[model samples]
Target: MEKSNQLFNQEQQIIHRLLLNAPFIPSVGLLTGQVGIALAFYTYYRHTECAVYGDFAGELLDNALESLDKSIDIAFSNGLTGIGWGIEYLILKGFVDGCGVEICENIDQKIMESDPRRISDLSLEQGLEGLIHYVLIHISASIKQNVRLPFDSLYLKDLYTVVKQACQEDIPDSFRSLAEIYMDFIEKQEPIDYPLHLFSFIDIVHLDTDKLTDYPLGIKDGLAGLLLKEITNE
Candidate 1:
């Protein structure tokens, strides 16, 4: 009986080590989602140069704030459910300290500097894509460093839960739809089955298969796919 207990203890120790060392244990979505939102905001700011789009730009900014508020509320509501609201608080605190205030002030100044009466004649969709590209580039290095391992369904589920919690606050219906689609895309992209309804906050969006190459997300997808396949095959 003592020998059997010793074997069980050894097995438990090994399992613990495996969980800690598992490359996919951490969620890459957190970093990617932040980059996506930042890019969306930057796109709105850069293309609102003419009066025609000025109101639209303002609306976009309002939407962003609403999105942020909703995300925070979600985090708070779920903070007690073991999803680590402390970390969310810390991340928000960092943004507030680092770029949050500065981004708002600078964006405002930039808008004011633009010609108030004329629109840039640029396609709004085109401009948004450009901003997303910039965001992808800016966040690429950091995300690559933090989530260097393959994707795992367990980690994706955890990440999705965290994001869902962050979406609990009031947000514009438009932003809410986009957020839902984003989560759905991530879910579909995962190589394994995750409990979808268990994390029901995200609404799946129709994605352009060709647009996957347009940003850092494309690279993330490729790398994650490769890693998951490699790990599972092993």
Candidate 2:
């Protein structure tokens, strides 16, 4: 168990460093697309290696999956929205798909059985609010890090303006209010409490269990085909 934990932590650190230092190409979608592909391949290799080796392999693979799932939860809880959200989703889905549904499902069920808090019953509205807070936190971090903004230069400003205008036109005030808070944080360079603030808005639970269970049929074959073609051409 100690060895497994060490391995899991090391892998996570490597992934996080890559995600943080990846060059910004001025397109969130493109950046995340590249990241998603790389992450999927890395995850597939790790999962397959463990699956091929029987003995204590199942336990090790389960640890790996659980660690990955927890990382995804932390990302979402920290306001990982937009392209980052999609990338993490693809990484999780692709890894599970590569691992085979039966194995993945058995692990997931075991996780849920052990931790009741692993699933949530939050409303969509509440979830959206959590997402908003997360976005705001990331925007503030971007400003501090001086990384190129993921969206258009004026995207955040434009969103604030549009929301304010909507308020004047008698549209719902909730979103506009949230927008105002985000704008303030961006302008003031205030630090966000991140995962702490995240928990205030949403419970710490995996919300998309059913989606995770499905495994995007044939994805493993698609990945295998690409690998085989590369080998043949090489």
Candidate 3:
């Protein structure tokens, strides 16, 4: 994980420019990528104790929403469920709360309003199912992260039902089956099964082992693998 200051500086400049207008526009991809990178760097620090990546990840997340002063809400240019993944990370990592939590909650509401059947693109990153996959990932994350019985025993369960119905009839029941497992884990009804179901979660998110480090965000690296990494890190 060692690197020259030049590489750090280059990454800084690139992310900085992309982040400047992030909060003001509907840049879900960009904003989510920023958060994913931060999580990767932070997780790298957590796993390997690398201060450089940790600090860089922190700074990246800290300055991510600079335009919040201009806009109160995180605007979405189109229908997307993965949009809230960044805010969820911010809260999970203790980066933002108060107004940040409010903003994050608003993002959830927007996601609920999104068309469960409308996947905007075919890329593994932004497709309807990909977004839904992430929604499942993040929803599972939220369930695991909660202190008060994990959002009252179910996080994003409603959204799961909405999108699940839109899927093909032959979709595997691992995720939703795990949904019950999730509830049980949160409710202490079947807590032992939660850990068992987690390994199966890889199927739900469609993780590609080879692409785990391909980038800082989107499907392969940030939003998916790193996200799962954080969950397992617990």
TM-score of each: 0.19, 0.29, 0.45
In the order shown, what is each candidate's alpha-carbon RMSD?
A: 22.1, 18.4, 9.0
Local lDDT at 94 for model 3: 56
Candidate 3 residue-wise lDDT at 142:
46
Worst 10 residues of 3 by lDDT: 194-203
User: Cα lDDT for residue 133, model 2?
Assistant: 40
Residues 1-234, candidate 1, lDDT per residue (tens digit)?
A: 345534334223322332233222222122223222222223323333434323432343234343332222111111111112112222332322233222333322332232312322222122221121122222232243353322234443554554454457664454344445436646664222122121122222222334433322211232222222232344
Return the TM-score for candidate 1, rounded to 2 decimals: 0.19
lDDT of 3 at 183: 43
Output the TM-score of candidate 2.
0.29
Evaluated with lDDT, which candidate comes out highest?
Answer: 3
Deviation (Å) of 189 in candidate 1: 42
Candidate 3, residue 62: CA error in Å? 3.1
**Candidate models: Cα lDDT each:** 0.29, 0.34, 0.42
- Report residue 154 deviation for candidate 2 (angstroms): 3.5
What is the per-residue lDDT of model 2 for residues 69-122, given as tens digits with 9 covering 90 to 100?
A: 433332222212322332323333444232222223332232223221221322
Mind giving the per-residue lDDT tens digits that candidate 3 earns over 1-234?
Answer: 976645434334333433343233333332344444555456556665757656776665565544233232323211233335555555555544533334445455545454443443423344443454444445455446553222222334553454445443444454345344434433464433223122232222433444433333432323434354544656
